[model samples]
Structures are given as structure tokens and as C-alpha cells.
Target: MLEEEYQKRRVLPRHLRKQTEPERPFSYEIRPATLEDIPDIREIYNYYVRNSVVTFDEKAWSHKRWREKFEHLQKLGLPFLVAVAPTGQVLGYALVSPWASKSAYRYTVENSVYLGQAATGKGLGRALLEALIEASEQIGLRQLVAVISDKGAEASIALHEKLGFEEVGRMGKVGYKFDRWLGTIYLQKQLNPRKKPGILKRMLGAGASEE
Candidate 1:
């Protein structure tokens, strides 16, 4: 889908494509996450879990669980990235995980980006999401989905829209948080449209069996 849209605009030369990469804010750096970053990531996420509707979890994640989650993404070769300040503090993180457990759903992934409470409104969320989208495409993912909460997070919703995600569906009052019912909004961005392979191509790909 992105490819189709790109073609509609004038095509950019290969070298020029890199120049079009989104510029990151100067004070912090975005990079692939390390195991050592897990503690900070968890602290940031736990703050939301305890104080906001951004996460549905009632309890904070345990250290063991956090380590396992990071390892799971690493084993799958999906991108898990963090934004860090020069002070070596983790400001935020973004990651892509398998959308579903089924084999046929392998090419599609769901994304999540969370910021430290203090880091909101800094354009860091946009920067983190853009990095995730690029990494997903490089790893040959075809679709990226964001399951955002429809509470007070217009900033998150707007960021998703700015990055090409469209509202695909919404579940009304499906979540209960902070003494009120909350809803979920699903937004999706098609990274690369999957093409149907011709019979010859399929045969070659499958090691051509006798008919």
C-alpha cells in the first residue's frame, strides 16, 4: 500500500530515500533496545499501568515477565527500540510484536509505543513510531496495527494518523479503568501489500513437486 502511494507521488531515487528519513529530536537518541534497558522500560510502562488507561493491566509487570517479553521479541527478530537521553535515562520505547499466534498471520504485527510521563508532548512518540515502521518493513512485515485506547490520548491517535494509520475498528466500552469504562480503537498501516504468486513462482518456491 505504501509502495502504491509512493508511486503515485514522483518516485524517489534509492539514494534519496535515506535522506527522507524522519529527523529525530536532538536531545535524545533512538536505538534498538538492550536487555539492560528493560528496567527503565518497565518503570515507564508500570507508571501508566498504575495511573492511566493507556494499559489495561491492573498489576505492574514483574521483572521476570519483562525479561521474557523482551526475549520473545528478540527471538522473533522483531524490532524493540528505546529513546534515551544523554544522561542515559530511557525516555520511551516502541516495539512490534506478532499480531496473532497463527502461522498465516505471521506477516502482520501490532505495535506499541509508550513514553515516560515526563516525556509526553516532546514529539518523541512520533519519532519512535517512525523507527518501528521502517524496521518492520526491513524485516518484510506487510501490516502494522495500533490498538490505542480511546480515553484522553488524542496525541497518540494523532501521531498514528500522521504516520498513515487509519481507524479500522473500535470496541465500545470494552475496557474498565480508573472507575470508568474505556474503549479501544484499532488503527492499521499497510507496510507492503502482499502479492499473489504465479503458479511457476509458487512451484519454484515450494521446490516444485510432481503433479
Candidate 2:
């Protein structure tokens, strides 16, 4: 399905089209990534980290470090996605990662969404997250986790719930950034329960669905 869609150049489902800009004012392409976007990604993500509780880390991540993290996620069989404007400006990114280092946790992954300020409230985060779920399922992942920040990110939290994720746990005062404490909200979604694929199995010509 993913390959067939990619070949046709369409990956989005209709219901997910909540905030596409007018007249396709916000046309975007979701493709495999390159190293070039890391700087822009860092700039966009650090903005939220510095200003909001969307993330708990206070320190700005360097592009190199971001690139390395991408490597790890890819190795974990997760694809990193970016939503870009028609002009190629990156609006946001989403990805899935292993929930734990143990082999037993391999079927369980975590999800994250980070968007630019200008992209907020425009449904870019939703798009990014939805894309990640599709990619995660295409790769045969079984579970997804969302670790949310708590200066109270109700909308972010609510979006996950609306998407079929259930709150599994919350840790109070486990995160300290921006001068105070932030709670960690853990949510999970089961992708599938039967088969699981490794990174190599999710490559372009891999098992992602040629339908």
C-alpha cells in the first residue's frame, strides 16, 4: 500500500486532511529524508523546546546530534517524516522509536511530533503524526508510545486519544526544563499484533504494501 501510494505520489488518507492550506496553499511531500534538513529541523524543534512544553528537553540539539538520532531511529526500523511547504520549507517532523532497549520491547515503539511555530494550529502536527503511524504500520510495528509534556499539552494529549491511543502512565515531576517541573504523559497505541518487521523489511522495495 505504501509503495503503491508512493508510486502514485499520494500517502495521505482523506480524513486526515483537516488543515491543508487553501487552494492547496500548503502542498507537501512526504519522502525519505536526506541529511540536509537537519539544521532546519533543529531550528524548528528548538523553538518549541525553548518556548513550550511540547518537549521536556531544554537544551537545543545540534544538527549533527539530530542526524545521529535519526540514524538510530532508522536503525530501529522507524522512518522519520517531515512535512514541507510547497516551497520546500520544513513545517515539522515525526518519528517512531523503540520504547526500550531490551529485545522484548522491540515490538513497542514511541512516537513524537514537532512542528514549527508558523505551522502550529494548521494541522501540520496531525499530518506528521498520522504519517508516522502509517509508516509504522507499514513496517509492521505493533505498538506506539507518546511521551507528552505537561505544562499541560492537552491538545496534543487529546489528539492522541482521538486517534485511538490510550493513556498508559503519567510520571509527575519527572521532567525539569524551562525552570520548573513538567509531567510526562505516556500514551500507547497498538499498531498490530501479528507480524513484526525489521528495518530492512521496511525499505522502499520491502514489505510496506505494494497495494
Candidate 3:
């Protein structure tokens, strides 16, 4: 099968994760983040970057640049979330930043979700995103985007579709790694007026690091 075709066929349950589900009451909390969250966030992100196609960076990042990424997120009013276990282990995180810098594209944002090796499939991703959406929609973002790597086309794509993002676009050959061409999948969802982003929502991130 063609790579894109093969991925479109994969789905992650076709059901969105909800608060009252049996997986309810997980011991983690998702909150906005800052510079202190970088090392743990790097550990979560690098795990996937090294072993999987979840991110398309051509090389592993150094500490300085990694810290810079999160810093940029903070300035954009994006919620760089950390899903923390009761003991304060950083399980995973999700963040969204400007899809484009020009004012015309201000309402659009692309996102990233990364989890530690031990945290996959335990519903931490869902929790992190649930919190992310609540935080982002409060500011004024009209839409949210997930740029899925071609190799992970199944799980992440499926999850986004179930969460209401439609497959709006894709770009081929823009990413090269592991001796192959990888594509980018763009998914989006509209926000209700009642859920529009608010100023206070940005403040929610200020206290994100908690024990």
C-alpha cells in the first residue's frame, strides 16, 4: 500500500477519551510549563525522537536549543503541558504554537505531544491533550493542529480524527530521515465561541510546575 493510504486506514479506537471513562482518576495532572520543565520534557520527547517517527528533527537536540523551544512556546501563550505522576515523574507533555508567524495566521497553531517510554498507551496522552485544549481554546485560537509523522500515521492520526480534527492537508518529501521520505499530516478542529481563549487561561500556565 502507498504510505499515506496505509496510514489513513489505521485508527486508535475510533472513540475519544472522556473524563468519566474507566481510566478516569488517573494519578496524573496536566498543567502549563516553564524552563524548569525542559529536562524532563526533553527526556520524554527524545525517547520518541530516537526510537520513533513522532518528530521529524534531523538530529537530536542539545540542551540549549531544547530550552529555547519551550521558551518560545511560553511567549506565544501556548500551554506547554506536563503530565505528572503523583511522585512528580514527568510522564508526558503537549504544546501548541503558531502555525505561522504572520498576523493573518495568528489564529492557527500546530501542536506536539511527547511521552516517556514508560507512559505510552496509559491514557496520559489523552489527559495531556484534554488539558491543552482547555488551555488553548481559552485564548482565542480558532483551531488546533496536530502534525503527525508518517510512520505513526495510525495511532496519532486515529486519535486526532476521533477528537474531531479532520485530515485537512499533507506535504510529502519535506522530511528526510532514516533513509526514507516521511510525510506530514495536518489535522484541525474548530472551537466553539463559548470555548474561545481568554486571558486568564494563559495565567493557568504560570503555576504549572507542581510537586
Report clash pairs, candidate 2: 1-209, 1-210
For all candidates in order, the CA lDDT equals 0.83, 0.75, 0.73
Q: For candidate 3, write residues 78-160 as lDDT tens digits.
A: 66788888887888888887776445556677877777877888877777777777777777678788888877658878877
lDDT of 2 by residue, 1-211 (tens): 6887777666457787677665646567776556778887899888876788778777888888898987766655577888877788887888776676545566667887877777788777777787788887776778889988866688899889988899998899987876787788889898853344654343433223333
- Shift of residue 22 alpha carbon in model 3, Å: 19
For candidate 3, what is the lDDT? 0.73
Query: How high is each candidate's TM-score?
Result: 0.78, 0.78, 0.77
Clashes of each: 0, 2, 6
Any runs in candidate 1 off by more than 4 Å, and if so which? 1-26, 193-211
Instruction: Give the per-residue lDDT digits (tens) of candidate 1, residues 15-47.
Output: 877666776655899999999999999999999
Give the runs in model 2 whose Cα sits over 4 Å from its true position.
1-24, 193-211
TM-score of candidate 3 to 2 decimals: 0.77
What is the lDDT for 73 in model 3? 70
